[model samples]
Target: MSEYHIPVLLQPSVEALVTDPNGTYADFTFGGGGHSRAIIEKLDKGRLFAFDQDQDAAEQAAKINFEGFTFIKSNFRFAKRYLKVYGVTALDGILADLGVSSHQFDEAERGFSIRFDAPLDMRMDREQPVSAADIIANYDATALHKMLGRYGEVTNAKTLAEGIVSARARKPIQTIADLLAVLEKFAPRFREYKYYAQVFQALRIEVNDEMGALRDMLHQAAELLKPGGRLVVLSYHSLEDRLVKNFINKGKFEGEVEKDIYGNDIKPFKALNRQVIEPSEEEIKMNNRARSAKMRVAVKI
Candidate 1:
């Protein structure tokens, strides 16, 4: 799994992020070290810190023995606290490749992909006690329905939640196949794969508390970045993208951009791209995961 992920928008993201070769940088999600490797290559005397919560990712990070690179085996939500331990209070740039990695989905036993028959364990950090199975088995119908509709944007969230509640009462929904069987009727006949993806995404997001973690990281990133430092984020879903956009534009996750008494914007970062960046068709053809990636860059103001 060392040669696993092909970092989405690798060149463009790095080019936009790294303005000073001798400045500090962090890769918030160092999945297979794809983005970390690229960042390290551009650094001459700078230090690079890569964070990954997954134990499996530690093995891949071990392969990188660069002199100025440090790997942190924790979530990026704790970036500020952990980086202070490393004597890094501010950063020149911070890159967050959000959501699940390609390796996570490709690995059958990880239970991230619908293509596999495995336990419903989608914790990016496997050490976490709450797995997808736990959510399916324990979350109330209203909670499940809200998660599906809000995070996954599934059209039939109510029906799917009701179905899952009904089925789990008969037997525990322990595996992917079991959950699929319970929610199969709600899957659209023509877009079954899309429906399954949405349902699985909702469960995964809740189990990992991904949105909560993301918000924490964004707030920290604002404080960590130095003036003119770049904050490049590659989000795989609309929910993630919206959060990044709002935080960069308004300095908060919601509401319009606030201004000081002088009528100047009070945002910490300035949008680098007026429109969101996406992978080219050719790039998407090479890596299907790239199709959903939306990279947004901002400079800390």
Candidate 2:
């Protein structure tokens, strides 16, 4: 097993919530329990409910000895339902460190990182039917085009989708290597395969319906929060970050500053901060995975 994922923005995010020591909190992605451990240190009477869909996360969950910690083996999209099982109708604060854990990327078979040569399977939940290979093999050209365009922001989405269709006629694209071979047709001249990584990220997002899950979790988190509750989200990609920023500021992703028909602002949230927070240079120097992280925080009004 590879070293577990190091939690990004660990201190800053926890400090945001732990400021209110007695308030109940939730960590939506409890991989390796780093943030949860910090939250436990702050709480005296408050309890924490954590969620991680991956079975690998459960092993790390076992190591947490903190009292009043409930680690659920499920995804955050189902968080509302699971929290209900624990009788948590509302939370005082919520934090979601979204995207694959470093543990998932480093572990070769999990296939989250382009650094490791492994199967192209990038299911955050491994039991799920959809996998990167399945997307490559089954998705039609139009679907692939929109996936690359919407998620990856690739310029040549249509051409790239066509390339997959053409290449897959000869053999099933079953691994990252196979996908890379197909992707090379449009690979841009760049620094260290960043483009390839972006394309692979787009595919992984589509395969797992990650955006769909994120949308659900965001809406649910909003509903599950008590007035004055804090919502802090760490997003590694632009699309995720945009959704979070808009939800915090405008209360919607459509980019319209939501208001009553009379132009009175109608929002359940007060933007705690307009600028996104990033990892310190020292933090990124220690963990390169922190390079792309952007954290946004909102307080329920």
Candidate 3:
């Protein structure tokens, strides 16, 4: 067992996705094959198409003994394409555990963790052109400041952006350590680490175009699922959770969970549970990264 990513809410999320007996399933983010393993175990001739952009995750998946599995080597945004290619227009359920895997953070060369001293490259798909270093070095002050504010939730986003612009101009902030050093300059000593994590998060979001990709993926999900199908989402951050919650409950990001002429809530999905399901305390203890996980399940109605 690699033990890098313990797979957050592995039981709850899998149970949500595979509740329908032998239904067609798609694990859009098959990081360690944990959920995939559970889903496959539930299937009897139930075709499951797994998607993982990371080549490492795909290679790791090949080692698993599973039936009714097909690996798609593409971003989950391309899920619609892959499903059509597989001749699966409608799926019984879709599960997405979005964001970077613990494996990516543990591998120092991947540069996803703040504890690492590696190049500032945080691309989920290595083929992507924009990288963390590129975002830090190239984004103008205003643009960088906006990213820092929105994605990182940094209090001193303006100062942080200025710091990066000034430092990169003098000598490019090319590594994770470089970014931290610059962040430490502006961030108070007590809050330095917290602030830096936010700044790095902002850069990574911009580098990966995470928001854009997420919006696209969500749209794909809404369209791909048949009426009354299941949509289960695991989001690590508020930005993602808000979108999922809004879309499922309201059927529109900004619109109120829609209402019918008679005042009944008009929605494509109805909340299966009122409260967000979190990883058990035990799971969080076993995998520290699971602390932030939130799982939500909705049924297409």
lDDT of 2: 0.86
Clashing pairs in 3: 250-257
For model 3 the TM-score comes to 0.95
lDDT of 3 by residue, 115-147 (tens): 989999988878878788887778898998899
Taking the tens digit of each residue's C-alpha lDDT, what string does model 1 give over 103-140? 89899999999999999999999898999998998998
Clashes per prediction?
0, 0, 1
Backbone clash total, candidate 3: 1
**Higher lDDT: candidate 2 or 3?**
2
Q: For candidate 2, lDDT tens digit of each residue in 8-77?
A: 9889999877657777789999888888988999998888898988898888888887678889999899
Full ranking by TM-score: 1, 2, 3
Predicted candidate 2, C-alpha RMSD: 1.7
Alpha-carbon TM-score of each model against the true structure: 0.98, 0.96, 0.95
Error of 2 at 242 (Å): 0.5
C-alpha lDDT of all candidate models, in order: 0.91, 0.86, 0.82
The number of the candidate with the highest lDDT is 1
| Root-mean-square deviation of every model | 1.1, 1.7, 1.6
Can you give the lDDT of residue 126 in candidate 2?
88
lDDT agreement of model 1 with the native: 0.91
